[model samples]
Target: MKKTLLTFAVVLAIASASNAQTKIPPNIEKLLQKNTCLACHKVDVKLIGPAYKDVAKKKYKPEQIVELIKKPVPSNWPGYIPMAALPNVPADEALTIAKWITTLK
Candidate 1:
């Protein structure tokens, strides 16, 4: 019983550590807040849309990401609802966010 409990605790700790969220840089965090991107996206976890880390996994170039922000493609993410186009986001800010997203694991 004692060995089983110890093994369970060890597995739980490993899982928790593996799933820990990555810390967002302050500058990027501010931009995300200002653009309201956090309303749907998170660094490591999926919210309304896919997680930034998942987006990073897609290996999209920063330019492509910026375009996606301005004009979302629903077909790219079948299950999730189409993202609203954020044409109002300044070009530079969008690029900044895209570059940061590409840096995610």
Candidate 2:
């Protein structure tokens, strides 16, 4: 029974991870590329920064995400290098990306 349960748990974990993959829409992908967000962050996996799904888990409002983009809080993310503030990203684009990020997972 224990072996069966363990196998089931592992399978469930894999399924959940696979399902969490983020699929950015073309517009959102364009915004991400324009802002260079993809350089440090990925939709599903951790790169130089935390994954978008992980950010979604934080439960921040879309506006909050925009604020963070403008003024990154290094303390919020330990171990990873601090994200540089992206003042160049337009407000509309930042909010759009924030909304898309919150939709993940």
- Per-residue CA lDDT of model 2 for 3-99, tens digit only, reads 9999999999998987765468899899999989999998878999999989999999999999999999999999988898888899999999999
Task: Tell me how candidate 1 scores on lDDT.
Answer: 0.94
Show where candidate 2 strays beyond 4 Å. Answer: 1-21
Backbone clash count, each prediction separately: 0, 0
| Residue 24 in model 1: lDDT | 90
Number of the top TM-score candidate: 1
Model 1's TM-score against the true structure: 0.89
Per-residue lDDT of model 1, residues 34-100, tens digit only: 9999999998888999999999999999999999999999999989999999999999999999999
Error of 1 at 105 (Å): 1.0
Clashing pairs in 2: none
TM-score of each: 0.89, 0.81
Q: What lDDT does each candidate get?
A: 0.94, 0.92
